[model samples]
Every structure is written in C-alpha cells, then in structure tokens.
Target: MNWPPVPQVDLLEGLHLRYGVLATELRLLSDGLDEAARTFRVGVGNGPDLALRLAAGDPRPVTYFVLLHLRDRGVDAVVAPLPTMTGEAFVRVDGLTWSLYPFFDGADGWTHGMDVQAWHNLGSALRAVHDVPPADAVVPREAFDVTRYDGLTAWNAASR
Candidate 1:
C-alpha cells in the first residue's frame, strides 16, 4: 500500500491488547503492500499466523459496519477483521488504525494465474457484495457492542 511506515510497537500493542494475540514475529507480506495500507503476516508463537493491516485512518466505524452487514447477508466475498476485546473491529494506535484477520495462505493474484472458474467465482463474489443494502439509516448499535471473544456476533445479530 502507498502508505507511510508505522511503528512495529504500536502494531504489536494494538494486536495484543485489542485481540489478545501475542505475536512472536511480525513479517512484512511485501507482495500486498500498497499505498492505502501496510500488510503484515503476524506469527503468534505456535498458532496459525494472522494477517494484520495498518491503514492510515482515524477510527472509522462505518467501514466495519458495512463489512459486517455484507457478511451477515451471506456474502462470503470479503475478509472481515476479528474484532477487539472491547468489540471494536478497528483499533487505533499512533494515529494509524490496525485490524487483524485470520490468514489464509494463497497465491498472490498478481503473480498466480487464474482459471476460467476462478474468474467466474470472482465475478459472483463481486455481485454478492453489490447486492447488499446500505446501512446509512441504522444506528449501528452493534458496532460498539462489547464481547469477550466472539466480537462480531452482536454486529451480525443487529444487522438481521
């Protein structure tokens, strides 16, 4: 991503305190780095590594609200971040927002070739995203709801 560099300390602290993930190693997934954000492949000791994205934004709740809305509608197209311990989907540390997601190891679309079916699947996913209704009128009560572990549950229920 075409974004400025962020401190590793800020990233680690946010992940640890917000998501309770104690990462042992933080490696840059250089392939996906763009101007909007910096992507990191976080290694949490013996557990499966997670994906971390550090984007320059001032804590936007609407972003996560829309993401949860789409996922609850059966659109399995987007990668929604795991919410924080306080149920916030995005955490701010040092003027940058960080979010964590379960990492799925796969080929980089830029380098890896795609088959016809893969292309069709991509189109279907995009269509699913487009079909979701807007959430401009809702109060987003679930966006800030607190949960100890299953943070997104409240958001899912609120959307329904």
Candidate 2:
C-alpha cells in the first residue's frame, strides 16, 4: 500500500499553480501586501508549495511570498510567522508558513446578512488589506519563475 500518494493538481500544463497562486495572492492582498516583498520557497504548506509545483519543480516559492506579505503586515490574524526559509527567512523548524488561525465564528456558513456590525467588520478588514502605502520592498518579476498570480476558478470534481 502506498503510504503517500502523488499530489492531485491541475492536469492542463501551465495551470497547476494557477489556482494556488491566485488564492494565495488574494489572501495576501486581502491581508494588505500591495507593495510587499515576495520570497519563494520561504517554507512549506499542508501540501506541496505552489510556485515550485507550477514550475513543475519542488516547494512553490510564491506561496511563501504571499505568506511573507501577510506576515510582514503585523497582523497575526491568520497564522503566526510562516516557517522561515532558513537561508533567507531563517526557520529553525520545518512546516507551513502561516500559523493556522482558528476558524472564525461567522453568523452562518451558508449566508450572512449585511448588518451594521458585519459591514463595519468587512470594511475594517477590507481597509486593512486594501489600504496600501509606500514601501521600500519590491519583488522583481524576473525572480518568480511562474506567471503572475491572478484568476479564480470554481472547482468541479465531475471532470476528474
């Protein structure tokens, strides 16, 4: 019996990192990383790192970039500081980047009304994530070996 199986990922060539990158980028941007510095392979996640996977390589570095963006922001809302790269980021441990934050107790999983408090919270989080500012950090595009992070797709299992 196989103790561990190969990763289940995008079959279409050049699309493997699409979803993960996009999702990670959104989460980072949403957490406020508009001009944040990015570092690939900063650490690992529950599964294979995204950037590396997309490059048809190893640990995706871009995922760590997103995590680093979030972590640099000073908001520990999600996970603790992502596992360091040991070389660049410096990690004495081996694990995921973000410290898995506890599940938020939303009013409902199916749906939530646009109440005043909800609106306030939404605005607050949005503001926090979207409020961009000037910074010395810059991630050269040439550094990332994959396409820029973008797009979101609804998953469908039937095709598989």
Model 1 TM-score (2 dp): 0.71
Using TM-score as the measure, which candidate wins? 1
**Worst ten in a row by lDDT for model 1:** 137-146
Q: Which stretches of candidate 2 lie over 4 Å from their true place?
A: 1-59, 76-114, 132-138, 142-160
For model 1, the local distance difference test gives 0.80
lDDT of 1 by residue, 99-139 (tens): 88888898855688898888998999999988887666434
Candidate 2 displacement at residue 50 in angstroms:
22
Model 2 agreement with the true structure over 58-132: per-residue lDDT tens digits: 344455555567557854442323232232332111232222222232354225457687778667766765554
| Pairs that clash in candidate 1 | 1-33, 1-34, 1-35, 2-34, 2-35
Each candidate structure's count of clashing pairs: 5, 8
Cα RMSD of all models vs. native, in order, equals 13.5, 17.9
lDDT of 2 at 143: 62
